[model samples]
Target: MKPVAILYDDIFLKHDLGPGHPECPARLQAITESLNDLRQDERYIWVDPPEASPDDIARVHSPQYVDWIRQNCEAGGSVYPALEGNLVPETYPAALKAAGAVIQACDKVWDGEWGGAFALVRPPGHHAVKSSAMGFCVFNNIAVAAQWLVDKKKAASVLIVDFDVHHGNGTQDAFYSDGKVAYFSTHQWPHYPGTGSKREDGEGNGIGANLNVPLRAGDGDDEILSAFNDRLKPWTEERKPEFLLISAGFDAHEDDPLSEIRVTTDGYRQMANVLKEIADDHCMGRWVITLEGGYNMKALGDSSRAFLEGIVG
Candidate 1:
């Protein structure tokens, strides 16, 4: 197996939410610090990506929303009321880079240059919608990457597996009507954003394509992993996606202040391993993952590193 490609840049650290913000720059710093050994090792390759163009973002976001963010940042605005995120002056460029980093991860994995790739980005994107930003998310990074693949004809179908503690309402909204992209998520129910019910599956042509397995707050490894084995695995086998993507978030860790889920370090690895199996079996091992929400710095670093280990193994 080839080494996993890591997409990162210092610019990601510049997307400061604000002082004492939970989604502050320290999250990335913690991840970087924890993964320092792996980064230096020959098994992992780190790549700095270019800023995503407005055209790139337009693939998934509405033109009007994109313009709003740009203008908002240029005018020295610091807070985005829609998402409740502090949008500093440098946030505009940082968000662009974040989207671009995920795109580059997809490009590398699609090209078979790496078995898998992870975009350790800030301003976590799973909560951002097509026309609005929410929950500390600016632009929906994973959505843009998947849509880009569809637009370029690089993939006929894509599978998005979001294992975040909170539901990826934004990613689901992006592909709700498109059968070409199957959105599957396992999130805490009755949580933030108040979405992700199993009944809220995709509409129109995508009715059966979206799968949401909403777990309870205290659901841990046994409960969460069983959901994957019983539902996600069989569903992926039926769909046989051409590519795989993950909205990887570690906020479910027991120590995280955001949620009450009790997933351990090993639990993250187990989930990643299952997803890796699905990718290997159906997608020729083409996988791209992007960071989302994970507030507990120590747990975030440990769990994310474990996820990488599961992927590379």
Candidate 2:
């Protein structure tokens, strides 16, 4: 089996979220440093990702929104008042690179060149909508990759699993009417963005394609893992997706200050193991994981390592 490819670079750390922001560069730095020892092993491969092409990013985002981001970045200031996230000139390029990492991971995995790929990037996506950026996300990386797969006829159906503490409202909205992409998420109820109600299964043809497992603020490993095993597993079985994408986030960990969902590092491992089994059974082990939200530096590094170990071990 080929080694799991990790798409990473220092450039990702350059998309500054500004001082005192929870989504800071130190998060990635912690993860990178924790995985440093693993880099010496042949089972893992680290490679820098190229910048995402604007045309490809347009796959899931509006052209006008894309241009607006460029203007915002070029203007050299933060984007959207109240968002609190900075958007320096380098932000646009960094966002492209972050998104591009996922695209390249998909390409490499689809080409049978890797067992799987993990895009360890910043300016974390998933909250980015088609028309605008939100929640510290500048671009919807996983969404764009899923759209690209469908556009290229690479996969008839995709399974997007979001383990973020917050609901991926942007991703859910992007594919709410498209049956080709089935989004399953486990998040803290009444959390940030406030959008992943169980009632919001899907819309139109995509009805029944979306599943949301909203946990209480203090929900922990057993509760969260049960949702994965009982709900997400069955959903994937029914859909039998041709590709698997994970919006991997560690903010749900017990130590993370961002949310109250108390999932442990072991919980992340168990979740990844289940997802890996699904991929092995349905998609020939083709899986792509991208960073999302993880605030506690310690938990982020530990849980991330556990998740990767589950996938590639």
Candidate 3:
């Protein structure tokens, strides 16, 4: 079996918002510790991620917006009101690497250098739009990678599956009208950023390409899995994606403080299995997963480990 690449670096720890910020460096630390045993396993390989160039990011974001973030970070960092967080000097570099990791993972998996890749990055991106950051996200990492696949790699079609507790408003907005990419999300509705209603499906050429299944506050693994098995399965069969990208957010875990969803470690495992099967059947097993939101330390760690186990198994 080919090794699964794990993209990570210490710079991620430096993109700190503050002492009490929920998206803290410790989150990555906890996840790394949980997967410590995998360090010696031949099936997995950890690699440092390269920074994304301005042009790579500009593929998804406007050039002006990209310059704005760099300028702000260089000028001693201040509060980014839109992002709802502080942008320290290190934030810019970390954000670049976060997006770059996903790009690299896409390249590796697409090239068959790895069976799959997981980008363990920070400043969790799912809320960032094209022009501005939001909900603590600096750049839409998954969106950037998705665009890269289409614009540079020339992948005819790609599938992006987001299972975060909150809607990936940024990602959806990126490919909402583009038929080359399909965005499917299962998130808690009437929540933060508030944009994942089923009625907000795609427009124009992308009319049926976007699928949103908004779950109620207390919905758990059963509801989420059903959405994947029923709604997403058929949707994917039609798309027949050339590559797969997952916005893997574990915050929906019952133990997480951020949301009311009750997905367990086993739930994530099952979800990964389903996703992997879809990739195998449609994409020739070409897939990449990038970390998104998962606040509870233990839950994030355990759930991530389980998800990876399911994928690599």
Q: In candidate 1, what are the lDDT values of residues 1-313, reduced to their tens digit? A: 5878888889888887777889988999888888889867897888888788999998888999998889988998656677675777788899999999998888878888887888999878988988889888989999999998888755878999998899999999999999999999988999998999999888898988999999998889999999899999999888889999999999989999999899999999998899889988999988898999899999998998999888777
lDDT of each: 0.89, 0.90, 0.93
Model 3: per-residue Cα lDDT over 1-313, one tens digit each: 8899999999999998876989899999999999889889989999999999989988788889999999999998998788777899999899999999999999999999999999999988899988998897988999999999998889999999999999999999998999899999999888987899999889998899899999998999899999999999999999899899999999999999999899999999999999999999999999899999999999999999999999877
Per-prediction tally of clashes: 1, 0, 0
Candidate 2: where are CA atoms >4 Å away?
Answer: none
Model 3 error, position 226 (Å): 0.4
Error of 3 at 129 (Å): 0.4
Which 10-residue span in candidate 1 carries the lowest summed lDDT? 77-86
**CA shift of 51, model 2, Å:** 0.9
Per-residue lDDT tens digits for candidate 2, residues 140-212, read 9999989988887558899999999999998999999999999999999998989999999998989999999
lDDT of candidate 3 at residue 109, scale 0 to 100: 91
RMSD per candidate (Å) reads 1.1, 1.1, 0.7
Taking all chains together, the TM-score of candidate 2 against the true structure is: 0.98
Whole-model lDDT, model 1: 0.89
Candidate 2, residue 129: Cα displacement in angstroms equals 0.7
